[model samples]
Target: MLHLLPLRTPLAGLGLCVLAGAVHAQDTLTVYGIADMYSEGIWGGGGRVSRLQSGGLSGSRLGFRGRENLGGGLNADFVLETGLNMDEGTYGQNALFGRQSYVGFGYEPAGRILLGRQYSSLYNLSSDFSIFSNLSNGPSSAVVGGFGGYEPVRGSADSSTGNGGPARINNAVKYESPVWGGFRFGVLGGFGEVTNDAGGNRVVDAYARYAQGPVDIAAGYVDDRGGSVTPLAHRRSWIVGAAYSFGSLRLRGAYLAVDDRSVANQDGSGWWLGADYRLGVSLVKIQYVVNRPRYIDNARTEGLGIGYEYSLSKRTTLYTGVSYFRNQDGAGLGRASFSIPSGITSGTDNDLTQWVGGMRFSF
Candidate 1:
């Protein structure tokens, strides 16, 4: 079990002593981060807009991770990560360490167990099999929208609640199995912590993946329960994906389905297909995605994206991309993720287009 202690100044000396004594030659700690920013121009919703934003390709973050060896192939590990908004020098997820905060133990032959806030198994599966790397602005982003509740409008709460997706889960306990013959699996459970309610706001996620040589395949499932009402409502989702690489070229595809029991007419399915080619220090990629609502007539959205990236150095890259979306029968899908302009109107068929250029640095 894990214990928490108040961080009072009076205990500073004792804390330092404990930390100093805990370290050994085999223990390791590291600090790492990524800084990504982009300039974008969007055309649609009766206007044209230009702006600077963060997380064009990947979210900016600072993270600290450490592992302490305990002999016999056993180890203790911890990670704390915070998301950053590079455009405005602010927090991305509304909380410090909102990206990830977890501590766990690992045994070489027995797999691992972790506790705290972390990414959902469904999100990890999408990221692993996507050729676009599952960027929020990439074409393949739509495929995972069902895993997390799909919000047609921007600036709304996207948490794992009634109608939201399961991007991340809080107060979670997770178990990950070691790879055996190129197959690996994991499970996660998040507790709502509500008094007298065991099923309130609970989350259950699981996934399995197999990778050998240049081919990879994965599948995942999630059941998210919302406790806001007397009887909880569930958002259940499932997905399957695969990727293949041959020489400098790679292809990827995925299919996802959602059954939202809390809301009417929210059931849907989405799919994406994409490919990328590498040439020396440059890479080119393209993807197309389609999303269809099960109960809404003619309510569907399709997206197409093409991007180019050039490596400036081992730690820096330059990228540019263009994306287009066609919304039919009152669908409100946009080109970019959370950064979509407010002018776009829902309940009407609209076409959205975006152009972006960005630079990313990692350390």
Candidate 2:
């Protein structure tokens, strides 16, 4: 008295489930990340020399991302990314959940708007200006004054906050517009994350960029209204850059200026130019950078760097580079970050020449 279902019908049901999964795939969550490591050495740290260290090739990190289609043209997206020290198993930047944590809506035609913790336009735009860019084997020459311990500011020094400028903003809202004909723009606001006065610790930032074919151009500015903190009372930073490529040859140039109203020499200006060429499985790049601290009486510094990278696979590569710095007027800007770690200092000086080599992998 029971009706028998066809055995093949089960297969059909399974096919339907698979099809449903695909159709609803946009509503599903996914996980993705990368792990990288490398060694580094510094010739001079303003005066002292440092030994080899891990993470010179790349900044090790792991992250997760998820997106959901909310019907119609709306979508939900979230990213929880964190950095790690591969050598010692230490976490990077901020507390446990500090790297990037936020949820936001996105539109294909319009753009993406994210809330919570994320990168600002300054970092987003200027990242390409540096040869290191989480890829080089050595430290960032931008750290010290550009000459190595001879310039006033050392590695990763906060020139803007030198005059009491605010560095990072909290409780910020960021908006990025889609590219139209190779042009796009971004704007962000930091809310101080304080419940007391709404506009007490507010900061505003914006940037515009254009990429047409092998040429890239961008400019940005950031203004921070310091809270009750010293040496961060007020700060402003501005940057501009252009890059172009022809065949296997590429060239780049950039300029940066920061104003810190707290330090004795509250104004600073910096600039750099470089080029890269590809040869079979290897890529070669060279760059020169400079910076000037305010009220330093013609205090300036410059750097010359050459880097090479060899591809091991589609997602893996090894690289090495060397740089020389010459300080003018006893300025040691070149060796600033030579011995300092990334995102660790504010307004210190360490000018020196640096050479770095490293490898990286991503998945």
Best by lDDT, which number? 1
C-alpha RMSD of each candidate structure in angstroms: 5.3, 8.2
Q: Write the per-residue lDDT of candidate 2 for residues 146-191, one digit (tens) a residue.
A: 2211222221222222211123335668898999999999888877
TM-score of every model versus the real structure = 0.87, 0.78
Worst 10-residue lDDT window for candidate 1 reads: 147-156
Error of 1 at 185 (Å): 0.4
The lDDT per prediction is: 0.73, 0.60
lDDT of 2: 0.60
On a 0 to 1 TM-score scale, where does candidate 2 land against the true structure? Answer: 0.78
Error of 2 at 108 (Å): 2.3
Over the stretch 120-168, how does candidate 1's per-residue lDDT look in tens digits? 7667766666666666555655333532344321212234353223777
